[model samples]
Target: MKQICVFILVLMLTSCEYFNVKKTSSEAILNEELQTFNWNDVDVYPTFSVCDSNETKNEKTACFTQVLTTHILGYLQNKSIVVTHDVTDTISLKFQVSETGMLSLLNIEADSLIIKEIPHVKELIYCSLDSLPKVFPAIKRGQQVKTEFELPIIIHAN
Candidate 1:
């Protein structure tokens, strides 16, 4: 009876041991990393050289927008787009700032008539946007990340 009890105890202990766990593949790792992260809100807003000194988040954002607007407006002053028809609309520009403080144009929203009237308007807008000064990207959880913004360009013609 003692030998039978000892054998049962050893069997239970051996059975409880875990074997080699299933190894994950590279594809599995990639898929696991494909989880989406929330980019709509960030802990730190993007900052410019002049705006970095601001103490509050709202202040910094306001300064950043002001500086960017000034830069784009300055660039646009040198270029002109003609509107053949009487129209009043806003051109929405979507852009992304890279993690390394570089700007890139993503999409532009404009009336088809505007595009037909001024075919090169897209190029002109891009040139203006590209000329903006470098700015630090937004940060979240101590890591720098790309940020997106939608800016509108109002067009009122008579």
Candidate 2:
């Protein structure tokens, strides 16, 4: 009887041994990775992947501005995109993201052929970072969080 009990105990221990434990669901994993996705381009700031701690508002603003501006300049620096030295206008870009968290290039600059083809520019990646997913990182009880951000870009040619 003692041998039988010992055998049963050993069997129970071996059967109960865990291989691996997965607490997070598939949806949770997909959502987390989707929220923290990295872009193909490295110049764009304010990306979901480019959050900087202890950064001042001015620093953030400057970083994003420089990123977008440099990208645009790189696209139009020497290439044959003719810009009117006299015509200067501030074009506003707005987007309406879908439930899947994607930045659809909603508004287009309908001024010229060059303007319309901006999306095709090698460096011209849309503001994917501006439209962050709802699954963005949430601050803990004592952690600092950014409440609001204005992802605006301005282009100038002179």
Candidate 3:
């Protein structure tokens, strides 16, 4: 009788459905989703009116930069700021384009002599940037985003 009772108890425990567990596929699903995720690289470069009709990304970027450089240089040259005493130097200006297509000056780097010689250099840079044509901000993941630009201004004094 004891042996028969032990056998019955073991059978009852094994036959219960509560002891069964199933594996979930969450790991596999997560891996698949990650494979389809898009990285944050810019899909489109910022555009100026001169670059608006460009067909390719590289062309648009190049044209935009060239046009911007021309505008800034034109302003400086017109103001007679590039004339110096036989010294050649480069001033690096960092700026940004907002999502709403406005230019803002961020920072500028120049030599001590250049800083002393150039009156209100920051103001001049701000004015130049303010004079730029409206831009179409860079696009990332199909949304407009602010972008930074670094421009090198080379002053060649003869």
Candidate 4:
């Protein structure tokens, strides 16, 4: 009876180890979370103060676009650009908004003809960007993140 009791106690202690759950490492959990996370999507887009905060994501986006376009167009319109030939082209502006809400030009895509016609076109764009209203940085996973934008502006001057 004494031997049987000892064997039973040993079996019970060893079986407890079998029922223990395996602990997951923090790095493994973080890796799994990152793999499931969508890197391309943002929780909130960069916005201007003029944009309504209560609006939906799509509305906020539209307001941002409209405000940005208006500001650029207004600046361009104020400039006295005189072209010899009827100039019509689409200018692609690539820019970035930093995590701190600063705007910086990345690249400008314009036809050679447009460049020839408006020698200071790049300068004008830079000035316009500099004059933009205060912007709010985009948010991803509750953290401010930098975002890049490519805007196409159609220019028609006679």
Better of 2 and 4 by lDDT: 4
Displacement of residue 34 (Cα, Å) in model 3 is 8.1
Q: What is the C-alpha lDDT of each candidate?
A: 0.79, 0.46, 0.79, 0.90
lDDT per residue for candidate 4 within 64-143, as digits (tens), equals 88888788878988999999999989999897899999988899999999999998999998898877889999999899
Candidate maximizing TM-score? 4
Q: TM-scores of all models?
A: 0.67, 0.34, 0.70, 0.87
Number of clashing pairs, model 2?
0
Distance from true location, Cα of 54 in model 3, Å: 1.5
TM match of model 3 to true structure: 0.70
Candidate 1 structure, TM-score to reference: 0.67
lDDT of 1 by residue, 1-158 (tens): 99999999999889776664788999988777656556578888888888878998889888977887677657756676566777676788787888998877799899887777767777877787765777899898799999999877765554
Off by over 4 Å in 2: 1-45, 48-54, 83-85, 95-104, 109-158
Q: Count the backbone clashes (under 3 Å) in each candidate.
A: 0, 0, 0, 0
Those runs of model 1 whose alpha carbons end farther than 4 Å from true positions after fitting are 1-39
Candidate rank order under TM-score? 4, 3, 1, 2
Write model 3 residue lDDT over 22-80, tens digit each, in one string.
76699988898879876545688788887878899999989987888888778776776
Q: Which ten residues in a row have the lowest lDDT in candidate 3?
A: 79-88
What value does the lDDT take at residue 34 in candidate 2? Answer: 74
> Following a full C-alpha superposition, what root-mean-square deviation does model 4 have from the true structure?
2.7
